[model samples]
Target: MDTVLTTRHLTKDFGRLRAVDDLSFEVKRGQVFGLLGPNGSGKTTTLGMLMGVVNPTVGEFSWFGEIPNHHVRKKIGAVLEHPIFYPYLTGQKNLELNAMIKQCPEENIPGVLELVELADRRNDKYKTYSLGMKQRLAIASALLNEPTVLILDEPTNGLDPMGIAEIRELIKKIAANGKTIILASHLLDEVQKVCSHFAILKKGRLVHVGPVDDVGKGAETVEVKADLPDFTEVLMQFPGTASILPENGVFLVTLREDFHSKDLNAFLIERGVVANHLVTKRKSLEKVFLEILSEPR
Candidate 1:
């Protein structure tokens, strides 16, 4: 796959404090890549360097295999904190001005408005719209250039549940069209649901980077209740079992990174232990995120 974005030893410092340190990663073409971290984990700083909004203290980044510059960045749409639009202007008028500044074709304006579901309210003044509508209009403005890659920093921040859902769905729709997305978010579930690949950052350092599917692979949590009074003995015999905790009449089993539910269930049968109830809660991205955050910095 072609690389859409790349950072090499990207670092940023504010006086004596380091914001991003030696951060390097690749966002492949057509992938929904997530930049995940806590409040001050350098997520925004990394994006800032990539978007040319903030100069890096050290290292470099590229977009579409080319060096950083306005010409290159114009092909990548980015929203760092919040999108700016003239509140007094109508939604359509604001987009028209943005289109002109970006040198985007006027013909694309209607299509973008429709894509953000603001076609009906295109003529309405921006100030009269709800917060969700405002954000959607911001998104519409970003699309004026029809960029191949869209970078969003906390796209769902400070929104109601319904508004969050709307932006999330809109992001999915954008990804469906084969546009590469690099989203910075503190929301683990949102990344899990929206991104194909992810990188975790904590205290200005990268802690993890991999495909989202790999988070749960071989790391399933199993809950089992057997008819026998003591099934722990057989469970303990399994070499792959990591930890087991008793819960009511059932056992919550945590397996090693290389073991899974199927292997555990088969192990019980071989030992002649019959389990009346078996449950496997597939590992969620939240589980993986918590694990990353809890690790020593």
Candidate 2:
């Protein structure tokens, strides 16, 4: 429940266009916080302001409880863009060189290489490795200083399916290690795979912020309608029905995980009643995201 980052009326204006408008939110300790939006939703601008690369035209923000400085910046490892290393250098050599420049201990090298699962390929030339391996090496480089927080912007930008999967697994492992992560991504599936909490942005404004479970429409929803007018009375008496609400001309029924739509049809048949229509909706995070975006602003 510790607050790691907080913003108050944070706004950024480039001339007349507002990039981030009165953005306010808190990122807590050990949470994978995702900033999600479309291509021009101000996600990158928000991160840049927090990292001190871009100045805010209005409002303010804090890391922990105070303004960020050089010391605070060191405690957070960030990769805003694809890190380009010497293509001919070995993976281990690349990390060692980066660590040297950061003044981090070379002793942290082996552990980080192993943590990223790249120890076996430490000596392989960067250009000779696959796309997935290259991304893993970038993660290893970021962890050289043993940072408490990690900021990644589109970490899986240019990779194949297998490469994306590999990076997802690596990020999950890092989250398991208890580092507070701030991930800015336009990929809904990517955020769903890793973030416990997320904030959706639309045109530089926050539209939604809550836990992943907040979007739970249901496990599976079934819409049932019968010819008889008093069918509701019968369904209310039926067992295994969690909720039954009339919507339009049909009743929306949600059943327990062990129950299925066929169970309801069978139950009605046993009571000498029949449903004229039935429909099923399987819940998913992507559906929720799309619904939120489709709502009127």
Candidate 3:
């Protein structure tokens, strides 16, 4: 696949603090890539550097295989943190300003508004719009130039559940149309649902990077439930146990590593135990996020 964005040992420092340290990753064309981490994990700083809003202290990065510069930036659209607009201006007027700055055709204003589901509210002043509406308008402004890549920082923040869903669906639709998307968000579930690839950051450093599926590939836990009354005894026999949680009259066991279900079942049978339920649990993005965050920096 073609590379849309590439970072090589990118670093940024401020006084005694390192905001982004030695971060390196690649975003493929037509792929939805997520930059995930908790608050103060440098997600926004990375995006700012990528968009040229904040200059890197060291290392380098490129867009479309070329060094990121004003010329290259034209091919990228971005929303860093909150969407900034003139509160007194109408949505249409705000987009018109963006179009002017981007040198795009004025006709693009309505098209982008409609694309973000803000066409009906185009004439409304920016201050009158809800948080969700403001977010969609920010997205519309980003789309004004029809850039090949769209970068968003916490795009769903402060929105209600329904608003988050709307933005998620909109992002999916944007990706479906063959544009690459770079999403910076702490919402692990949202990233899992919307992104195909992701990188986990911690304390200004990149700790994990890969396809979303592979990030948590071996993190799944096995759930075992038996008719035996001594569930604690069964757990004691298993070595390398990570955790055990009881739910719905069953014990959910999280193992340190992968294990065969057949072997587990056989062990229970040999102990004169009859298992009514035995299954491997799927690892969620939330699990992966937490694990990454818990790792020592």
Best by lDDT: 1
For residues 89-206, write the lDDT of model 1, one tens digit per residue: 9999998898777777889999989988999999999999987788888888888899999989889887899889989999999999999999999898999999999999998999
> Judged by lDDT relative to the true structure, which candidate is superior, 2 or 3?
3
Per-residue lDDT over 1-297 for candidate 2, one digit per residue giving the tens place of the 0 to 100 score: 889999998899999899999999999999999889888889989988898998999989999888877667767887776666899999989988988777889999999898778899999899998766776778888888988889888889888988788878878988999999999898888998899999988889999999876666445678899999898898887776888889998999988777788888899999999788988765666787788889997
Off by over 4 Å in 3: 230-248, 254-279
Clashes of 1: 0
What TM-score does prediction 1 earn?
Answer: 0.89
lDDT (Cα) of model 3: 0.87
Better of 2 and 3 by TM-score: 3
lDDT at position 227, candidate 3 = 68
Q: Which residue pairs in model 3 clash with each other?
A: none
lDDT, candidate 1, equals 0.88
Query: lDDT of model 3 at residue 137?
Result: 92
Q: What order do you get sorting by lDDT, best first?
A: 1, 3, 2
- Candidates in order, TM-scores: namely 0.89, 0.77, 0.87
Give residue 164's lDDT in candidate 2 (0 to 100): 84
> Candidate order by TM-score, highest to lowest?
1, 3, 2
